[model samples]
Target: MNSKKLALIQTAMKLFYRKGIHAVGINEVLKVSGIAKKTLYHHFSSKDDLILACLHYREQLFIDWFKQQLDAVPAGKAAILAIFDALDSWFNNRSPAMGEFNGCFFINASAEYGREDSLIYAACQQHKSHVRAIIKPHVDAFEADENKSNQLTDSLCLLKEGAITTAKVQAKLSAARDIKPLAASLINHPLRQANI
Candidate 1:
């Protein structure tokens, strides 16, 4: 996209993440981005449109960063366990691209847009599904059975979501680390030994 549009989305994302989407108005995004109202209108038809774009942008940023983190480690169980280490970095504000930890952006968005059929809610769900997909391959490597792998993937996603939520709500920076052993146990369960 053009520099102007990218600026609008990034600025809006930062603001929307720091504050709620409804709490940050279009004017603030315009002012922070140093772009004109007409320009924002040219890129996005409405605030909701911009919000959607921001969500997509955030998802891409997160997915890319998360993949990089996973790639740095060996695949299979190591890569799976690296997820929490990555979350720990994120919770500690080590991810510059993601900004400070205020909680999962998708979770916050889902809370705001609670209606199941809404595009915003759908976007949030899509983000979650994408995250689960990313973790599936690693789970598959360690769990041969299709059903077991699917269940393991879902369980890992739950642990991830719980870490994010706990880190945000309880202000426990070690939430990811704290939950890592449980995840390790789940990965190393007796039923999964056949694949390993």
Candidate 2:
């Protein structure tokens, strides 16, 4: 991507994440990025196009960061639980790469673009699916039954979403840590029964 286009996307992303998609105007993006209006239009046909690009950029950055955090811990159940620890760090503003916590960007996008058929909404949904996909492998590693593994993955994803939302909405900075015990129980139920 050209430097101008990348700059526009990055600027728009921070603005959108910090504020809301509808709240930030193209003019603001241009001002923050120091890119010309004509250049933004040259790179993106419309503001919606730029919004989509920003969403894509945010997804890749977030996924890469999330994967790295998971990889730092042991895999399987331990890694799955570490997700909350990662989220705690993020919520506490410890992870500078993720920027300040303003709730999940995808969640914010979905709210602004509530229509399910809209491309922006779809992009948000895709980000969520990617999150679940990242958790699935860890769940699978610990749960042998396919059905059980799928359920476990769903539970973990739900917990993650809850943590993000609570941290943002309720201003509960320890939301992630607060929810960790529930996740630990969910992930270790079988092992506990077996005394493992």
Candidate 3:
């Protein structure tokens, strides 16, 4: 993509994420991005196409950041905690400075698109499975038992999904703080140890 198109996509994502997808329009994005109409259409066929590109870009950026955090922490339970650690940074800085401190981009878009065929929906689905895979290795590293990792990955994903929704609806931005105890409980559980 050209620098202008890339800039437009990046700016649009930030705007859409901070403001709901429905609330944002092409004119607003164009005005904010300061990109010309011909340029925008030359790169993106339509608003839907642009939205898809934005979603894909956001997904890639998030995954890259997530992987970097995981690498910074130790493997297994320690690495799993890193996910929460990264979330904590968001919890700490919930304000206009960083834009909307709402919740997961996937969750927001999913609610908006309702599992439809839109690119946002497809990107959301792809992004979620990618997230699960990222945590799979850490879960698998728990003990001698191979399956425990898969189980742990599921449990962690559930916890994450709930956390995102709960934090958004309840206005408890620091909700990730709750995950530590839950994660610890899972890590130190008797059934998990017994399986090994």
Index of the highest-lDDT prediction:
1
Q: lDDT for model 1, on a 0 to 1 scale?
A: 0.92
lDDT of 2 by residue, 1-196 (tens): 8988898899899999998988999998989989889888899999899999999999999999999999998889989988999999999999998999999999999999999999999999999999999999998887998877877788789899999999999999999999999899988895442332
What does candidate 3's lDDT look like per residue over 95-193, in tens digits?
A: 223334568888888888886776678789989999999998787776556666567677888887787777788877677888778877887682754
Model 3 clashing residue pairs (backbone):
139-149
Name the 10 consecutive residues with the lowest summed lDDT in model 3: 91-100
Better of 1 and 3 by TM-score: 1
Q: Which regions of candidate 1 deviate over 4 angstroms? A: 190-196
In model 1, the worst 10-residue window by lDDT is 187-196
Question: What TM-score against the true fold does each predicted structure earn?
Answer: 0.96, 0.95, 0.89
lDDT of 2: 0.91
Query: Model-by-model lDDT, in order?
Result: 0.92, 0.91, 0.79
Clashes of 1: 0
